[model samples]
Target: MKVLVLGSGAGGGCPQWNCNCAMCAAARNGSRLIRARTQSSIAVSPDGQRWVLLNASPDIGQQLRLQPALQPQHGLRDTPIKAVVLMDAQVDHATGLLSLREGPPIELYVTPCVFEDLTTGLPILSVLEHYCGVRWHMLPVAGEQRVAEFVIDGFETLRFRAIAIPGKAPPYSPHRHDPKVGDNIALEITDRRSGKRLCYAPGLAAVGPSEFEWMQGADCLLVDGTFWTDDEMITAGLGSKRAADMGHLPQCSSDGRPGMMDALDGTRAGRKLLIHINNSNPILDDDGPERAELAHRGIEVAHDGMEISL
Candidate 1:
């Protein structure tokens, strides 16, 4: 399995245009400790030739421009990415599909719940139908597929399953607060030839038994690192919601409560990394205590253009 961190920042990306937050300030000043980043997204390939994006961010155009291997080739209009697999219907995750509308028809793997949200509330899909058409592959919950397993084209070397996770859908969706089985998911992708597993859940609220089981012994575990503390934004004067309220499990402990680090004690993943980092998170500062703690624990912070192979 070949993995590439296409963009490592959360929704607005590091150094958001309208903010002058500490980290954003540093990023804008070209501080090495606070490198700029785009919205969160990743690409994976069983073989280097054909790639599939885990999620398409609004920065898709710039993200692709930065990675040569993902650029178009072979024809006048072409792209190395063959498809996109969405984890949820959040604005940051699904809006990038518009940037891809100029090329060939898009092939997507998504839950019917998310598909409906895009078709109605967001209308991204309904709009795309008039552009380069979309091929929707129903990404079923594990064990729900007719063949006992779902497969996407160009990904035969891998076995992947979407595990229903307890999370809120985007505010634009009718099921935003109601929560449904397919509103959100975490993916477990395994490379058949190498027996390596990758468990990805960038938008996480709380840890569940099933989520821990999926992370157990994974070769690469890329989980959420959106906020440093549950009240990060509140304290930073950025927002009023706690991390959990926004569907992200903060990395830091507060009020003597265990954090994501404590929750991951037994997983023992070969390599544990953090993804979808928010610009407000102090962990982005390489010299900060938060970052040092993660390093001491052997956990890496994903960065744009970072590559990992297993």
Candidate 2:
């Protein structure tokens, strides 16, 4: 199994436009010690020929251009992407669906809530209605959804289990008035051909009991690292909420509490990585103290262009 963990930054990406933070500034100045990134996403392949995107990021075009395998060779019809596995309905994660509009109508697997969001407000289907070869498959949180020979098992995120801060909810739904909803999922995909497993959760809120079963067994686990310390934005005065308040449990939390790092380090999974990073996170500095701590825990921070074979 060949897996490509694409863009690894949070919603605004590392060097967020119009931000003058040290990290962003250093990145813009081409400092090797600092790095720039796009919104988070990943791609996997059973044979390295038929690729499946994990999420359609805002940076899809540049991401595809960086990967020769995904580039179309025979005009448009020869695109390699076979499907898209959506993790949530956030703009950064779903907006790039348009990048593939000219190619085949790719299979999209998402939960009911996400389906509603996509259909009612964004209407991704409508945007690609004229694009032949598109397909939409409704996937659920607790059941199996199959695509080709791959068996995809989904687990719900802590969107409902965790509280959403006032005025910090997704800009798309201000009232938060959906009938029955929450940010839909995280996924554990297994290739029947290779018998290898991958667990992907970019916008993770927290690691709950229900998700442990898959996390403990998967060969590779890509989890959220949106904030190195829970109060990152708070301390920086860039935002008024803690990482947890934003629906993402920080890499480490406040109240002197240990966070997701502990959960992942204690897990039995062989390969573990942290993704969906915030620009403010000190861990983004490869040689920073926090990065040393993650390394000491045997955790790998996901980086753009990083590849793993299972």
Candidate 3:
């Protein structure tokens, strides 16, 4: 199994154009300790030639332009991206499908609830109809006894399953507060040939007993790290909502309760990395206490262009 970190930042990316936060300012000033990142997204391949993008982030164009592996190598219209698996219908995660409109219709695996958001509220699928059409594949949640397995064209050696994580829908959807069973999900991708597994959940909210059990004994676990504290955005003056209000679990909680870090502490996965970090998160600063804490616990912060093979 081969994994590539296309973009590692949360929505709007690091040093967001309109943001002037200290971290953003430092990133704009080209601080050596701070790295500017694109929106969150990742690609995985069982054979390196055929890749499956997890989330079509808004920065898809920029990310593709810099990654030679994702670019067309045959003539001018060929792409190695064979399929896309959407975690949710958030604009930051789904809008980038437009950037891929030039290619042939690719397979898209998404939950039924997320598909509803794309068809009604956001209507991204309706927009993609005029461009390169999408072959919709129903990605089943944990208990849909019917074939929940999604198979790609040339990547049949890899097994894909969706684990319904605890999360709500995007604000733009009608199901925002009334989320169904499949509004959001985590992917457990296993390379059957090598028995290597990867659990990916960049939009993680809460971790209960079932969620924690789902993460056990994986080769790599790439989960959410959107904020450092519950009131991160509020304290940083970046937004009016707490991390919890936005369907994200911060690394640290204000009420002295267990948080993201504590949840991950129990995971027996060989490699655990953090993804979808917000611009306001102080962990972006390499010399900050937040970064030190991650280092002390041996957890890595996902970065763009990072490649891993298992």
Candidate 4:
């Protein structure tokens, strides 16, 4: 399986537009030690010609503009991308639908809940039909499907399941009680010919038993590394929210403690990498102590344009 792990940055992207932190400063000044990235997404291809984009980020147009081979040859009505799988309804992950408005009718896959969110006010299909043609396919949260030569499975996520976090209300809540909606999900892409697997969970609140088996067995694992510590934002003066409050797993530190590194232990999985990095995390700089710690653990920090084969 030839997989392209696209932009690994968190929602706002590394080197956030308004921040002036050291990492952002270094990245802006052309220091290779510090990296810049786009939003999280991926692409997979069997013959290297046909490709399916995982999520259409707001930066899709620019991402494709940078990579000509992945450029769509057809207008809004015709595209090279066979389909698009949406992990959630977050603007960062789904707003890029506008870019594909002119391309060929896209085969979009998403959980029924996410589809409801997309169709809440204006059905995506109707909107797309107004702009261009689009094909919709609702995927079952815990089911699998065959699209083209690839087999994909969708796993419901704990973070996006809309089970209100302790002491907080669910986002996009309803009236009396918060509406339970699955906000996040994980995708496992398998090559029918080679039987290799690549598991991707971009926004993780916490690891759960149900998905543990797949993570342990995946040939390549891309898990969330949004915040180095639960209090990272607090320490950085970025915000008062905890990692879990933002719907991401705290992998580095928690409650003034320091065992967050345990989450990325190399021995837990054969091939593991961290993505969806937040701007406050110092690991973006290669020379940082955090980077060294991850290197020691045999965990690679995902970078933009990085490619891997399973």
Candidate 5:
């Protein structure tokens, strides 16, 4: 199984336009330690030829351009992307579906809640229906008897299940309701033939008992690292919302309490990486103490174009 990190930054990306925060400023200045990133997204392939995008970021076009494997080669419109699995309905994650309108019909996997949210709130499904044929499949939430199975061109056996994580609906949703099952989720993909597994949770709010149990012993675990500290945005004077308030639990809490890092420190995953990083997070500065701390703890901060083979 191969996983590709297409983009690693949060919503607006590392050097967000119109923001002059220190990290963004350093990135704008071309600081070698600071790397610019697009919004969070990844592509996974059971075999190199057939790929499935985890989330389609707003910068999907640029992301695809950076990866030659996904480029057309056989024919004028041939593409390696066979399907897209959405983790949520946020703009950064779902807007890129528009860019895929010109491609051949693609399958979209999402939970029923996410499907409804997109239909009523963003109307992405409705709009895409006009552009191209989209085969929709409902992703089975955690604990469901059935799992979503797919047959990639070159894979022997593969299946995926969605594990519900604690998170609320997107802030912009017309229906501002409390967190519910399917509002946010993590994906666990298992290659039955190879006995390798990967868990991806780029929008995790809190890691509960069930969530941790689901991630145990995975070959690769790519998790949320949206903020370094809970109050990162406020401390950076960028926004009033704390990391948790924005549906992401920080790596470390503001009061020095244990956070995601503390919780995931000794997990048995073969490799652990942080994704969906916010621009204000100090970890973006490669030389910063925060980055060193994460390294010491055996956690990697994912970057664009990173590839993992398991």
Candidate 6:
């Protein structure tokens, strides 16, 4: 199984257009320690020929331009992207679907609640229906039959299971008051042939015993690293909202409570990486103490264009 890190930054990305925060400023100045990044998204492939996008960010056009493999070749309209799997209905994760309207019909996989949210709240599907055909697949997130097996490029079969993680609905949704079973989820994908497993959860709000169990024995685990502390936004004076309120469990907590880093400190996973990083996160600075701390704990910070094979 191969995975490509298309974009590593959270919403607004590094060097956000309007902000002049330290990290963003550093990125704008071309500081080596602070690299510019786009909104979070990834591509997975069983074989190099065909790819499935994990999430399509608003920066998909730029992200695709950087990936030659996804570019057109045989014909004017040919593309390697075969499908897209959405983890949630957040704008950062789903807005790029609009950019793909010009491409050929694409399959989209998402939980039923997410499907409804996109159709009713955002109305993305309704808008896209006029431009191109979308084959929507219902992603199951509960019960013993949660795994959805599908063939990739007519050669390899991969199984994916969406595990419900603690998170609230997208802020723009009219049904935000009614959070459903699949408001947010972590995806566990396994290569049926090689048995390699990968777990991706870039919007994690909280990690409980069940969530930890879901990540056990994976070959690679990519998780949320949106904020260094719960009050990161407040401390940086970027916003009044806490990281927890934004649906991300910080790497560390200000109240001496265990955070994401502490929970994965001694995990058995062969590889653990932090993705979907926010511009305010100190870990984005290579020379920062937080980066050193993560390295010491055998964790890595993922960056755009990173490729991993398992």
For each candidate, give its TM-score against the true structure. Answer: 0.96, 0.86, 0.96, 0.83, 0.94, 0.95
Q: What is candidate 3's lDDT per residue for 64-148, written digit by digit as tens?
A: 9999998898886799999999999999899999889989995899988888899999998988899999899888753453225
Clashes of 2: 2
lDDT of each: 0.87, 0.72, 0.88, 0.67, 0.85, 0.86
In model 2, what is the error at residue 110, expressed in angstroms?
1.1
**Candidate 5 stretches greater than 4 Å from native:** 142-156, 254-257
Candidate 4 residue-wise lDDT, 199-238, digit = tens: 7777767654455555677678888878888888898887
- Model 5 C-alpha lDDT per residue in residues 1-310, reported as the tens digit of each score: 8899999999999899988999999998876489999999999887788889999999999999999999997976788998899998888899899899998876888887788788888888888988886888887663442234444344456677777788768866654465557777788888877889999999988877777787778889999989988888888898898887888889985575568897778588888899999989889988889989999999999999999998
Candidate 4 lands at a TM-score of 0.83
Candidate 1 Cα errors over 4 Å, as ranges: 30-32, 142-148
Tell me the deviation in Å of residue 199 in model 1.
1.0
Better of 1 and 2 by lDDT: 1
Backbone Cα, N, C clashes tallied per candidate: 0, 2, 0, 9, 0, 0
Candidate 5's C-alpha lDDT?
Answer: 0.85
After best superposition, candidate 1 residue 91: deviation in angstroms?
A: 0.9
**Number of the predicted model whose TM-score against the real structure is largest:** 3
Stretches off by above 4 angstroms in model 4 are 30-32, 73-78, 121-126, 142-181, 256-261, 266-268
- Writing each residue's lDDT as its tens digit, candidate 1 over 1-310 gives 9999998899999988898988999887866488788999999999888998999999989999999889987988888899899999998888999999998999999988899899999999889989998999987653343112467787899988788876788998997878777788888888999999898888888776767777788999998989999999999999989887888888877777677787666677999999999999999998889989999888889999999998
Deviation in Å, model 6, residue 302 alpha carbon = 0.7
State the weakest 10-residue window (summed lDDT) of model 6.
143-152
Candidate 2 lDDT by residue in tens digits, 108-169 = 87656566667776777676787764577756442242212234222211011111111122
Q: What order do you get sorting by lDDT, best first?
A: 3, 1, 6, 5, 2, 4
What lDDT does model 6 reach?
Answer: 0.86
